[model samples]
Target chain A: MNLHGTPLSIVIFALFVAAVLFLSFFFARKAKSAAGYYAAGGQIHWAVNGISFAGDYLSAASFLGICGMIATLGYDGFLYSIGYLAGWVVALFVVAEPMKRMGKFTFTDALDAKFDSRGIKLAAAISTLVVSICYLIPQMNGAGSLVEPLLGLPHWVGVILVGAIVIVIVSAAGMTSTTYVQFLKGGLLLIFSTILVGFVLSRGLSTEPVGLESGAPRGEMTVQATDSQLLEQGYALLHTTGSLQKYVRDGTTTWWKREADGTLWRAQWTSDGVVNGVAGGVLEPVGRLRQIGGMSEAEAAAGTGSVGPLDFLAHLTHPETRIEQWQKQAVTDEKGAKYAVYTPKMVSGTDQMKPGVKFKVHTTTEKLNFVSLMMALFFGTAALPHILIRYYTVPSPACARKSTIVAIASIGFFYVLTLFMGLGAAVNGTVNPADNNMSAPLLAMSFGGVLFAIISAIAFATVLGTVAGLIVAASGAVAHDLMDRFGRMDLSDRQKVRAGKIAAFAVGIVAIVLGIVFRGVNVSFLVGWAFAVAASANLPAILMLLFWPRTTAAGIVASIIVGIVSSLGIILTGPEMFAGPYGLTAEQAWHPLGQPGIISIPLSFLALIVVSLVTKNRRVAVEA
Target chain B: MLHGPARSSGPDPASGYKTRLGVVMFIIYCVVYAGFVMTNVVNEGRAMQTIVFAGLNLAVVYGFGLIIFALVLALIYNHLCTRKERELNVTRSEKGAGA
Candidate 1:
């Protein structure tokens, strides 16, 4: 990616960061009171708030992960868009006006409104922190991922950079700054992605794919040997009947075979090309076609091994092969250098769809489950804490509602465009085989240098907008919910704002560290966990408190705690976490692979009802 | 009659109409959802898969029937609360008149 020190991109990014900071500081001056800092004094126009909603809601996962998944995996990615949009129905029809009427500062305030219970406040606050942090991890991870390819920096550097920038943005103005940044990013991300999509369609598909070397298979390849010496030295021995040939040393192989000229020859295969018809049977050039039987018309036209232009939509909508070829080697040496290997069955398509091949989404009933999961991700956006907080910045509840509607329109349209952009990347032939996250950026490169630079920069901005909003939400939980509500710090407005700034910095640091730790996990899947947790921990409490008259303060507290703990427990014990990080086997894992919503959400609701029923008459007394 | 805050006395007539409208709309949503679910379950043959997929799509896109349910529940609650408010207001006015 070698994007290091691109003076123009650096200048552009720096200016953008500075502009956001300046806006924050400007808002800071107006944020003289806790209400102003926390809720933008509830005076912002609906249009601005709504666009900011789009900005805050479309996190790195939405832009990078979903787009990348769609590019690589097809229609499954669009399922995320559908799920995300549907979640807004819940937000608009259920949560909006009631939330505005109930809470003054944070989501916690709303839950504890009727009960006035410190226990409820503490529990809700804790849930907010946990969900916020869980959601923040993927955002931070996306930031780090973007930084490397965009600015040519190390992954950790990218993580730290986003963390620092977000803290400053949050500390400077609070919701006000966070709102505008989201507004800017949300608008820019859509516009730029639209532009990128246009470029993709205009470029169209070429009959002859570009950037591929002639005489190589459509997919990547590897070699295996059964001897330690061959394994250590990276050589393979080819045997036919009674004849034997060894390919070894200095990136060249020697093999004997009949040539196309009908002459026997020994040839050496070099990294650049094959020298055939003499020694090792004339290293014949491998054309960009692999013999796969019974391919569809769309598949054939796209390319022998890659997706084509006209069939872009077809490839996206239909199932295709996902091949992962690995060489197995046996080493007998003490240092484990030498090995013998053979090309075991190269797993491709339906074979790769088997469990344990790759992530479950690429290969199981989990694929449809994955679609439902992504739906949760997409719909979960409008209901998020950081997103809802932005509504308070708007002037009236009507504006909040209107802005949300606007957000829906804009976000909805952008998600539609993601389908095209993702398909374009899938067939573009410029994709980094290992990193699907780079699909959009790499697709941009296929067009020209300028488009690539611009898209990459906008992707960077996408991370910034999302991270800033998340940091604000986290800081609010700490300073407003914890410090004031729980700690009972009767601090002045200025002191509270200062405390929030400090909290932002601390949370930002934690985010950066976690981002570095979970480096290679799919951002989209991680996002699913966040949504599951949010739905379980926050959604149940908020929904019940607003609608259920019998919902006691104890119920809210119990629901929040139970929701947070159970969801976290399910996630920690689920296959992805247990097998991957905790070093446990899949079967030994406590729950099924990923569907926590199916269980934890119900449990949270049950806990709230049971607890409330038990303590229906016991109301908390408030001191005057 | 017991005295109370005027705003909390009872439901306005206008509010009652709104509540009825909300309930109607909610019923429409539920009916539509039920139809989709039934069609999905009953249909067979090759077209059955398509129908089932559509049903799944509906469930995913509308959010598992919860949004409609929430709206209906909220409307009912609002209707009850508004009635309570109006009644309280009327009771207070009657008490004052008697005094």
Candidate 2:
């Protein structure tokens, strides 16, 4: 879909960017020291930090990517919601309180707290930089996606726009501005989503409006519509699958789509077509929710008038209801020319809600990939460099605990809301084939343009909040951990801040380039790789340092190095990087599973234990 | 009442209980979540997606249940740990005064 910027949405976007810059400058006045710059001088209130935690944690991936996934793929998208919330269980139980009690400036500070080894510092700092940059790329990608639709700017401009804004935001006030920005983004996302869900429930479900009819034969069934009628309908007619071209055909309003073989298929008002060699009544998109399964013809006609939350999910589970599902297929035309087509299929509501729809787990490789993604998400939250650094912004160990709990509550609530929002997008008929990231904002457009503009602005802010945190962690790795601690720079406080700012700018530019390079890949999918890398590299060292009594400094360094190298090795050769971004076929990729966590996580732990045991005698000898 | 801040290391009795409670909660979470994965693998998502409510499947409900379960378990841990810390501190103060 070629999305033109509405004036309201562009203005809202400009105002949001201006507000974020103002916040950076406002917070910059107080960030005079290393503590103030890196950790907000450890003065953040637990409540504020808690919301900020939600802010930092819920990136474009969570808001846009997950919603888009759910909208397009049914229940599979909600799996991320579960896996993401589960990670905080690790953070709260194994990480948060202990992290505050130990570390001062950075995540590396915590990793090297006990050994004070230069090797540990160097390894941890490098892993932090790697994880932060990987995480930064997705946020930038999401930004680029948003800029095209909201401001009508190109994707690269949006990527650069977010990159420049975030560099200034992080380099100016560091954690202080980042935290506040996250707080704002988190709060608004929840509030607006709740409102959107409210609209979904109240409006209930309906098919094509009064102008459209049922059982009008299986050819072209387009109805003449004035611009006022389209506005009255709220959103443009959206199809779940292939692009719908609305025009007159044989004196009737028609929705036509061209096949790869120079043939045009028309979707009539009567849902009848032979899809995938199966003859069935197809679910046509008329910018309204179709009647669900288990609903009697009359009851469905009544449209579940103003349902409660339970009623919404209950209605979706009915076997009788039909859902529009988009399936991607590569087909060769008569000339042997290949094109990727996203064809919409009318799926049983019960089947759409089932597992096989999105994650076809019957295949062994798919099962392993699914489990690997879950593993990464489960362990990754505590290990993420940005998330770990947020723990230090609060004052006491207990505050860290309380904030973790508060964050769990806030984040958990937002995730629950994501299910409804995703479903709302699915039913509201705005799952653009070109950009899944715009689903939530497009769903907002179904309500009104004003709401659409606000949601788009908030979604952009979501990227800003997350990217700023990533830059802070990356810069800290360069300036504090690498330069001052391991590089033996002997830098003053002023010099450290300068080094950090420079690192932030350099990293921001790299992020912009990568974001442009990988434009249409789902942000959440990229974050999955980031999590796998973070868990594999960082979690093993953190857990062992805190738990194993015999953890040697050499063991820690060796394990982190092993974890980082192995995961990156696997990821670079993996299917997603090779076939997805690199334009190679799946069989051409060196590795099968996209996520490395199921392999690399245990490998790191094993490396730590073996290396620690081997160096046990050395530790005793040194003590003597 | 605002319970006092958590103790910062140096061998307080409360740290042991906190660690124990944390381990137990983590283990429970691990088992339940792993069980979720195994069920999906073994049954291949059929058992989980079976409709349990009016038009709501077990998969959706169970996923939601896991999220709420984590929060409730966290609350229980916080409560138990805070109470143990308070009790141990009271006992320590009494011994100190006598000595």
Instruction: Supply every candidate's count of residue pairs whose N, Cα or C atoms clash at under 3 angstroms.
Output: 43, 6
Stretches > 4 Å off in candidate 2: A209-290, A336-338, A520-524, A620-624, B1-13, B89-99
Candidate 2 clashes between residue pairs 3 or more apart in a chain or in different chains: A222-A253, A222-A254, A292-A321, A293-A320, A293-A321, A294-A320
Q: Tell me, per candidate, how large a share of the native contacts it keeps.
A: 0.00, 0.43
Model 1 spans with C-alpha error above 4 angstroms = A1-5, A207-235, A238-379, A520-524, A619-624, B1-99
Q: Taking the tens digit of each residue's C-alpha lDDT, what string does model 2 give over A141-214?
A: 88887888788888899999999899889988988898888888888888888898887787676443221222
CAPRI band for model 2: acceptable
CA lDDT of every candidate = 0.60, 0.77
Which is the leading candidate under TM-score?
Answer: 2
Model 1 docking grade: incorrect
What TM-score, computed on C-alpha atoms, does each candidate reach? 0.73, 0.87
| Candidates 1 onward: DockQ, in order | 0.07, 0.35
Return the TM-score for candidate 1, rounded to 2 decimals: 0.73
Q: Every prediction's TM-score for the first chain?
A: 0.79, 0.87
